[model samples]
Target: MKYECARVLRGHDGPVFAVRFNEKGTYCMSCGSDRTIRLWNPHREGTDGPTSALMIKTYKGLHGYEIRDVAIENDNSKFVSCGRDKAVFQWDVASGKTIRKFEGHVSSVNAVTYNDDCSVLATASYDSTVRLWDVRARNSFVPIQTLDDFTDSVTSVLVTDHEIVASCVDGFVRTYDLRAGLLTEDNLHHPVTSLAMTSDLNCIVASTTKGHIRLFESKSGVELNAY
Candidate 1:
């Protein structure tokens, strides 16, 4: 695939820690070290003159410290964000009101995701654990499973129908079976930075702090290739 730099949206005064394209792929939400979450219309039309590449919509005041991560729900109606303030807030995308605030992680929450069915939400934190929340239940937040062997903080977490994968600062990618609570495998030689699952669910793409992106088989924990 050939790509070109269309536009550069320059607004955040600090490094952008995370960016998530909405499910519809029209808008993009970004969080950064500047302690702000800004929405941008990446698809906005451009003029012949030099105009701003992206339009900022809502600057929500949900996080008090540097925003680390943000995740949109499967329905695209609401989103969740966490930051260095040791708090997680669920916000309505339309009204920008904080619908819920989950407080548990002693440090910053680094990652968040909604389950396939949109029933359960998962969050990873600098406290070195992942917490699950029942979205339908009233203010229900709890740590369903804790993988506590990492020597450093858990940087990211990915959940599929069959398994949960967590990347830690200690250069380990640990996969856990959702049903048995067993550690399936630990692969990768560098600290994992991000994770993406293939469409068919047969492979996982993991990016590392050492500037390498690796692919692994979903079941056997085999390293397929790296780029």
Candidate 2:
């Protein structure tokens, strides 16, 4: 498949760290060094490009530092974002207001993702940990679980129906099986920067800081290929 730039989003004053489309692909959420989270209609083009008008909403006044990652819920009713402020924020999309703030990580958060049903949120942080928070719990500031096996910063995280996958600067990609209560660690021997699963869920693709992308069999931890 080939892709082309249909529209250029140009609202953020600083580098945008992450941009994610809602499940339906009707909208998108972006966060970055500007310390703001913006909702955009990427499908719309405004002559030169989508202007500030295409920016549906701007969430501000909460994160005191640069926003690193943003995750939109499956239904697009809410979203989650993590940043240098060391806090994870859950926002109501329509109101553009923060609904909850989950704090525990002692350092910058690098990635954030929602579970299959939006019941939970997982965050990777520079503190070398991945945390799982119960999204529907009220008045709760503690994470439901914390995985801290990394020797270096956890750079990325992804949560699926049955497992939580994370990549770290320690040169490993870890998968936690929620149902089996087991952990699988695949040592790539390179500082892993990001991770994604195959659409069939049978394999994982990991990218490293050394500029290599590796594919692995999801269940067996076998390296399939590298590019």
Candidate 3:
């Protein structure tokens, strides 16, 4: 298959840092250093094919700093944001409202993710910790648990049904089993900047700052290949 750039989404005055689509892929939200999150319609009718995106809405004034990452909840009605502001924000997609603000990180929030149930949110920060938040607990900004075992800043985090996988600036990926309280670390030996699990949950991939990507088995954390 061949692909090409369909649009140059312009709006944010600064570099756009994060972009994501809802479950239905009907809408996409993008954020940047300008602190504004813009929504677009990639599938807008009459575009013919890959063309300029249809701008829908712009969300701003909620964050004091650059928005690092945005995550869509499982239900697609809401989304979350985290970034240099060192806080997490839950926003309503339709009304563009800040449903809640979660705070506590002492440094820039680098990445954020929601669990399958949307009941919990896991946040990674430059403070070298991955914090967990209970989303529905009204104004309860306190983190339920702070995983601070990493010696370096956490760059990315992904939560599964039973474990929390975090990639760090220390050139390694760590998996924490929530039920067994067991910790396992796999040494990529190259600063891991981002990570994600395959849809089948059988494999994972880590991307380093040097432009190298490594693959691994999600279960044993064994090195598979690199490219």
Candidate 4:
């Protein structure tokens, strides 16, 4: 595989905590510890020279706290973000206006993921819980299920077709089958920092604090490889 170094977008006064490429792959959205979110057009060529890259536009004032995670809808029309202020904001990408603010998490939200259909959103928080919100319904932010056995905070979460996977500070990764209402598996030797799913939805990649990446079979929750 080959890669090209694109423009370096520099505006945030603090470290960037989360970034998501839009569905069309033409633009990218980012949020950070600076309590701001920025939108960039990565394909725009720089005018001055090769050293410069275009900074398209920016979206600000959506969060009052440090924005930790961002999830863009499939249509690219809207996006959602969670922050340390225990709030989630939904924004219209075109107008950059706050469409709605969902509040429920008692602590900082660490992770956020939108469903494939963009109808539901899942958020993980330091309060050791994951809440699901119906984006289309008003006043529908609620925790469908709470998985509690973590000795520490929940760091990341990924929602799959039939299950939800969450990583905790205790170095354990757990899977909850939404239909079964039970934790299917718990395995790991170090705190998991992030989670990603393969395009086929058959595999899951988890990054741990121990500087290791683990790949697991999504269905059985069995380790396929650990690096």
Candidate 5:
């Protein structure tokens, strides 16, 4: 397949930790070690072929430290970001305003993902736990369920149909059932840098700093391929 560079997003002073586009794919959002969140147009009109994206807005001062990961809600109205601030913040996409702050993780949050309807959100943290929160519920920021089977920090998390899979720094990927509770664990034997599941919920792909890219059966730890 042929590939080409489309757009370059700039403006953060420090290393960018995460970048994601909304479900509509019209705008892209980025966060970084500079402790700022920026939203920009990924497909701006009347731009030259190699032009940089037009930054729509820049948000600072809310997060105390670097922002690691960002997830745009399915509806395209808001998005969530988590990072070294040890918390998660939901922001209004149009107004660039903070809608809600979910503060509970004692350690830096490594990742965040939302459910199908955006009614639920899941977060992984350096505290070695995975927490699930009700997106629309307020006044109680406590996680509805806490999955803490990992012995080390949880590096990333993916929320599937009815399950939650978390990648751990200790070389394991643990899967939990929202109904059945903890289900199984896959031994990567090397720190798992990230975790992702196929949209059809048939495959799981994981990457590690050791230069390993692996694919597995989503429901089971059965290996399919690796590089």
Candidate 6:
């Protein structure tokens, strides 16, 4: 495999906190301390220039504070963003308008993501809680469920078909099985900052502040390896 610099997205004014490619990798959504979200077409054609990566759209004014993270839905029609404002803004990709604002977190929201079908949104926050919101529910702004089992800030969250996984500053990675109603906890003994799952959905990869990356079996919470 070969990798090279494709194009540089130079619109954001400050540090970009998160950048996520859509499921198809044709485009991406990014947000940061600039309190703005920009959509980019990284593979745009024609002669390369300083701004070769075409900035398709810029979504702004909805977030009152620095945006911490953003996640795109599977269809790429909409995306969600969370940040220091303590609210999640669900935006329409084409119109660049906020469709809904899901607010409840008392502190900064560190991460936000959608479930497999984009029916549910899971958010991790400095409030030491992970909240789940039902996107299909039109009239509700409150979370359908809130999981506050962490003693410290919850930094990352991801949802699978049957499980919602969250990692916290408390040094634990917790997985909640939605169908089986079971909870599994894996103590890493370090403040976990990020979480990712394998494409096969069978393993979890967690990164901690101590620079440790640990892999665990999804079902059994067994540590497979560490780096």
Tens digit per residue, CA lDDT, model 1, 184-227 = 65658788887888988888888998899999887787889999
Per-model TM-score versus the true fold: 0.90, 0.94, 0.93, 0.90, 0.93, 0.93
The model with the greatest lDDT is 6
The regions of model 4 sitting more than 4 angstroms off are 1-4, 46-53
lDDT of 3 by residue, 49-100 (tens): 4566778888888899999999998777888999897888989988999989
Cα displacement (Å) at residue 38, model 6: 0.8
Name the 10 consecutive residues with the lowest summed lDDT in model 6: 45-54
Better of 1 and 4 by lDDT: 4
Candidate 6 lDDT tens digits, 25-90:
999888999999999888884235854688888999988899999999888889999999898989
lDDT of candidate 2 over 80-139, digit per residue (tens) = 889998989888988888889999999999999988888988999999999999898877
For candidate 4, write residues 111-207 as lDDT tens digits.
Answer: 8888778877888889888888778887665655466766777888887777788888878777887788777656787788988889888888989
Give the runs in model 6 whose Cα sits over 4 Å from its true position.
1-3, 45-52
Clashes of 2: 0
**Which of 5 and 6 is ahead in lDDT?**
6
Give the C-alpha miss distance for residue 72 in model 3, angstroms. 1.4
Cα-based lDDT at residue 26, candidate 3: 74
Q: Candidate 3 clashing pairs?
A: none
Q: Supply the TM-score for candidate 4.
A: 0.90
Model 2: residues >4 Å from true position, as ranges?
A: 1-3, 50-53
**What lDDT score goes with residue 57 in model 6?**
86
Cα error, residue 102 of model 3, in Å, equals 0.5
Query: lDDT per residue, candidate 5, 12-66, as tens digits?
Result: 8989988887777887789999998888887773233456778888877778889
